[model samples]
Target: MENSPSVKSVAYPYGLMLAIYSILVLVLIYLMNIDQENWVIGTVNSLVTIVLYILALRTFKKKNGGFMKLKEALKVGLAIAAISGIISAVYAYIHYSFVYPEFLDMMYEKSYLDITERNMPQAQTDQALELSKMTLSPLFFATTTLILNLFFGFLISLIVGLIMKRENPAYQ
Candidate 1:
């Protein structure tokens, strides 16, 4: 195969999906004002992201003479995911900090209510609310998102790579 696939080739599809998912999430939070119960958005994003990853891997395989080793697939998949995750983290930081400052307050209030409902001591409730506020900051949120994204992305890559790996019969 003369035209071997580069990491960039895989990153392209991942980046495209990340962009679409980012826009959809921002629109959901901004224009649609659908800021809460993000499970809906998360679910959609996770499923689509996986599909995009699979497509990218298959494309890479095709370009590599229609075979991919397990190790090669794992590296490519993880790189694609890391790039996608960094892009997402940066966008999320900007979106939440500048685009929707009100989102922080809204989340804080919601958390406060949930905490209060527990009927814990007022001091504990205050502490919980304080902790939430501290953690909800843009920097912290971005850091957490980055960590979670990488964790899940690596996990997904393991499964996807195992399924996608194909040995070249001629190699043996």
Candidate 2:
């Protein structure tokens, strides 16, 4: 525990990585004309996120004599993702609600079309569309984005921390 760096020590790298990732997302949204409907773009962005997490953990290990406890690694990883999630949630709400208010409607229309293509009854299609709309609502989108971020971050941290964990022989 004494060997591990303080959480604040890694703050700069964690925050800078998240900020860059967020900006990259915004850039992709504008340049590639991407929206949440296309899961591929988001998946690509997540690759960068994974790299950032690994780097953060590696940096922490380097600073703390090339060792970090699992608990502390989880703290760093989750904290980075959670705070990043909050930042992203705010951005998502503002972008969808203000910058491109039509985005959500576009998603609904696309989803409706996709669902109707299944050849379901009109009543069933309507019900499905309504449910889709609820799921894609601004509030739900932001909230789920935050939760998913934390959830995935937790998983990544556990795996990475396990791989990176090393005990101080002297302390042991």
On the 0 to 100 scale, the lDDT of residue 5 in model 2 is 77
lDDT value for model 2: 0.79
lDDT of 1 by residue, 1-172 (tens): 3335787777767765765676577666688777556897768877887887788778888888888887777777777767767777787788789988788888888888899999998899889988999988888877776777677667776788789888887774
Structure candidate 2, residue pairs in collision? none
Residue 103, candidate 1: Cα error in Å is 0.8
Q: Top lDDT: which candidate number?
A: 2
lDDT of 2 by residue, 1-172 (tens): 3656777668556855685687567757866776654788778777878888888888888888877889878988888878788877777777767777677888888898899899999899889988998987778877877887789888988999999988677677
Query: Which residues of candidate 2, in runs, are more than 4 Å off?
Result: 1-3, 35-43, 119-123
Worst lDDT 10-window in candidate 1? 1-10
TM-score of 1: 0.84
